[model samples]
Target: MIRFENVSVTYDGSARPSVRGVDFEVPEGELVLLVGPSGVGKSTVLGAVSGLVPHFTGGTLHGRVTVAGRDTRTHKPRELADVVGTVGQDPLSHFVTDTVEDELAYGMESLGLAPAVMRRRVEETLDLLGLAGLRDRPLSTLSGGQQQRVAIGSVLTPHPQVLVLDEPTSALDPAAAEEVLAVLQRLVHDLGTTVLMAEHRLERVIQYADQVVLLPGPGERPLLGTPAEVMAVSPVVPPVVDLGRLAGWSPLPLTVRDARRGAAPLRDRLTDRQPRPDHTARPPQPAPPTPGRRLFKRTKPDTTAAPPVAEVSSLAVRRDRVQALRHVDLTVTPGETIALMGRNGAGKSTLLGALVGLVEPSSGSVRTGDAIPHRTRPRDLVRRVGLVPQEPRDLLYADTVAAECVAADDDAGATPGTCRALLSDLLPAVADDTHPRDLSEGQRLTLALAVVLTARPPLLLLDEPTRGLDYAAKARLVTILRGLAAEGHAIIMATHDVELAAELAHRVVLLAEGEVIADGPATDVVVASPSFAPQVAKILAPQHWLTVSQVREALR
Candidate 1:
């Protein structure tokens, strides 16, 4: 249904082409996953297929790019709107309507469909996408997962033959992410709609894909073939895939359920009816802190009973009719690192917003030692707490990275020399005079971090710091945050990256529907929560090994 032959998209006011001589094809009814680190032209390819590359994005197109036998270079987005539906990485930027029902009808209205047709189509879509119950809710009131679903339903109402989504679940918690994916899977299986999605979280979507397309950045061609074929070549493989490789299993396990089925003895072992040695590996971990373990550190500053640095009690927040958080309680000591995780729409982000006093709790409240968090001003919050939003560019605006850092400082913390020194470490040799927004996605995210650090908040909150970042960029972030923690900062981050959580979070808290379901040390919590369990090392030994480093250390 889509074809690109030596396609190169050159953007205006830029020398290098965004996409360089790329070639690929997606046949009808095939679910092909397009994956690479951010800014690798994956979105450009999608735009080309949907007739938005050279059209809306404003670029000179070279070579041939066609979708469903129609040349994209000649057709505008409106002309191809009926054949292709595109949803971007962020849903907020795409919402032009107020309510969920209106969002779904916008696309159809643009097509000049009849009112009768629109009503019938909207009703069918709402039910089909499980959005009927949420029809009257405002788009702003819906959860991240619900918002994305509305975005999908908006495009899919016309029943487009080809559906393209870019990182649809990147911002969602695990559960909310799963809910949306299930709807997508149903659309593909039941309606036979062709799907082409680009995503970073491979573990969640790889199993459902019939074909995998691995796009390696610059100077490399796309890898197209079966999931097993492409994963073997990619630098990283999903955990279950890695397990299948190690276990000498046939065909391969695409999902945990697939792994269980093909491994042959998993269910038998669960029933305590197994003789196979492979079926039984490690003991299941427990819920709370183990007695006598140093789960948290203590210090003697002055007073004998000053209590913890951060505290939450019976906190609750309601998103319209849905209670995003309910009677949730948590605490963090000075210098402690906590990772927040849950299924998408499970309140991970909500809890983080509560921590910073953004979402006023419906009842109960969050309090920090000598201060009240809710009553604090935004400027005061920044001085005491730092946050890096999900999008890199949201916080960037200054002319230069150095200037961006200086803007956060009140002429006290950020001197000209200090700003230069901070950029030297955070962003290397990024030109001090270059526009902060002009840099690459990773560079922009790094620069944003430099700005937040200028305030030097004792409490730091990072929301999905690894999104759109390359491996090298992610490492630099981990290093910077680790140093901050060592220097005694209470850093809390809401993230979808379980591996990062395993490595960085001194404590891990599982948030679901705005409740703190699980909490404790990182290793202990990960071992208990299947969602945070290590795919490779956990399968390898499963004993006292929550991470590869632990396994390596034990082996040594």
Candidate 2:
């Protein structure tokens, strides 16, 4: 259904092609997953299918791209709308209407479908994507994950023969991601729909792909094969595949079930050896003495003791008619890492907003250090806490990367090269002159994180920190965050990436319907919940192995 012949794309400013010698054929009714590291042109490749690359993006395309027998070179995006539906990484940019129901119906209306047919398709999409409850909600009022669902439903409602998605499940929670993937599976198997998706979270979708397209790097020829064949040689792979490689299992397992079937002997070897203690976990500190009246006696204060970085008591937040948060209580201490986890619209982001002063509590209280967050001044708040919001672009305003870094230094009173240095460490390939708007989703996220880190606040908050990051970039982030935690900085991240939580979080705080549902050590909380458990944990069930690194360490 889709064919790329000697394809290469180069933007106006670039000297070399972003992706070169990319040649592949995706059969009709099959799901093809595009896998690669950040900046390897996965999005560019997806754009070519929908004719968004050279047509709307102002790039030069070499060779031919055909979809459903129509040459994409001749067919613009609007011209191919009847047969193709595309959803990019940022869902907010994809919406033309304010409400969920309207957004879903907009595509069919544009296609000039019958009103009755449009209504029926809209309802079917809403139910398929689990967006029935949110049908009436405004796009702005919904959570990031909810917006993603609406974006997908909008494209799905048109009933196009081909769906081209970029990071389709990046913003979704575990359950929501599963629902979306299942919908795609149904489309491929029952309806004979074609899907071409590029995603950084391979663990969630690799098992479901009919074939895999591996883009090694920029200007490199692409590799096309079965999922197992590609993953065997792919640098970026899911934990289940990594575990299979470590165990020397033939034909690396793509799913948890397959890995578990071959993990009996490995489990036996780890039964006696305990996993290493979580480095993010802090030992209990000695309690301070009770206050007593020292009549006219002079005494020195204890400078060694550190107070909690953030304290929340009976915190309640309301957005529109929805009670976003309800009587939630959380405490953050220095040198601690916590993962805020739950389903989509679970009040995780709202809680982070409350901490960073972005959302005012309807009732109760939120304190960062000594000041109430909502009442504190922005200048003063920057020194106490910093937040990297779910939409990283919201934090960027400058025209170029260097300008943003310079502005970050000035705003945070940091050293001249502070932000740039951090960005270099996190992602070295981004150029100084590149526009912040032009960077990929993962690169934008890294830049935003660097901007926030320049402040070096006592407490740090991140919402969906690994949204578009590949495994290498995520590992660099883990290292940077670990160093910060070691230096007595408290980190609270609202995320749906269970693997990230397993690798970095000392504790997991699970929220549901604007209330705390589970709170404990990361291993305890994640292992207890089947939906939130990482691949390794699911494979080595009854053994409490949360990550491949832990398993590797134990075996060694």
Candidate 3:
């Protein structure tokens, strides 16, 4: 259904093609997963399908890209809208309507479909994506994951023959991501829709992919084959596949079930050698006085007791008459990493907002050191707390990455090259002169994080920090966060990436309906919960293995 022949794309100012000589054909009714490291031009290839590359993005396309025999080189995105539907990395930019229901119907309305058809498809999409409860909610009010569902549903309502999605499940929780993937599976199996998607979170979608497309890097030939064939040598792979490799399993398993089937011996082997316990055992100094006690520890005036960098007590946040957060209480002491997790619209973002002073609590209080975050001055609050929002672009304004870094350094009162150095450490491949807007979603996230880290605030908050980051990038982030925590910087990340929570979080705080449901050590919380369990935990069930690294160490 979608074909690319000797395709190469180079932006106006770029010295090299973003992707070059990419030749592939995605059969109808198949889902092809496009994956590679950050800045690898995965998004560039997906854009060619819907004619967004040369036509809409102002890049030059060298060869033919056709969807259903219509050459994208000759046809514009609007002309191909009927046959091709594209959902980019950023969902907020795709919405043209205010509410969830309206956004879902907008694409069909543009297509001039019958009102009845539009309404039926809208309802089906809402149910399919778990957006029924949110049908009336404003697009802006929904969480990042909710917005992603709406963006996907909006395109799906059009019922295009070819669906192109970039990081479709990046923002979604594991359950929500599975729902979206299930819907995609149904589309491919039932309606014969061709899906071409690019996602950095391979673990969530690798098992669902019908085929795999590996873009080694810019100007490199693309590898296309069955999922196992491609993943056997693919640099970026999910933990299940890595475990399979470790055990030397033939025809490596892609799903947790298959891995578990072959993991009996490995599990027995690990039964004797205790797996390294997760890093949640190290509680912050002067651990809460009692199980339910609220201890008010502060950075010392003349002593060495570094108090909790952030504290929230009896917090309630109401927006648009909806209780986004209710009666929540939490504390983040220095040298601690806390992960906030729950279903979409469960108020994870709202809680993060309250911590950063972006959202005002309807009742109760939030304190970062001596000052209440919402009441503190902007300049002063920035030094005490820094947030890398889900939409990292909101934190960036300068055109070039170098300029943004310079501005960040100035704002943070850091050394001249501080932000740039952090950027290099986080993402070395990204050119300093590249426009922040033009960087890949992962690269953009890294740049935004570098900008935030420049401040070196006592409390750092990240919302969906690993949305588009690949395995290597995520590893670097893990190291960075660990270093920061060691330096007495308190870190709280609101995320749905369970693997990340397993790797970095000392404590896991699960939220639902604007209330904390579970707050405890990572192993007890994630290993016991099936939905939030990482691949390692799933494969090594009852073994408490949270990461491939942990398994490797245990085996050694």
Q: What's each prediction's TM-score?
A: 0.81, 0.96, 0.96
Candidate that scores best on lDDT: 2
Ranking the candidates on lDDT from highest down gives 2, 3, 1
How close to the true structure is residue 309 of candidate 3, measured as C-alpha lDDT? 81
TM-score of model 1 vs. true structure: 0.81
**Model 3 weakest 10-residue run by lDDT:** 287-296
- Per-residue lDDT of model 3, residues 1-556, tens digit only: 8889999998999899989889999999999999888888998898888888887799788989889999988888999999999899999999898999999998888889999999899999989998899899988788899899999999999999999999999999989999999999999999999999998888889988889999987789899999999999999999889899998899899999999888999998899886565466764453222212111223322225667888899999999978999989998887789999999989998988888888988999999988787888889998888999988889889989999999998998877898888788788888878898898888889999999888888788999999899999999999888767665677899999999999999999999999999999998999989899999999888877888888889878
Q: How many Å off is the CA of 231 in candidate 3? A: 0.5
The digit string of per-residue lDDT tens for model 1 on 487-541 reads 4567888887776786577788888767888887776777776667655424532
Candidate 1: lDDT of 53? 83
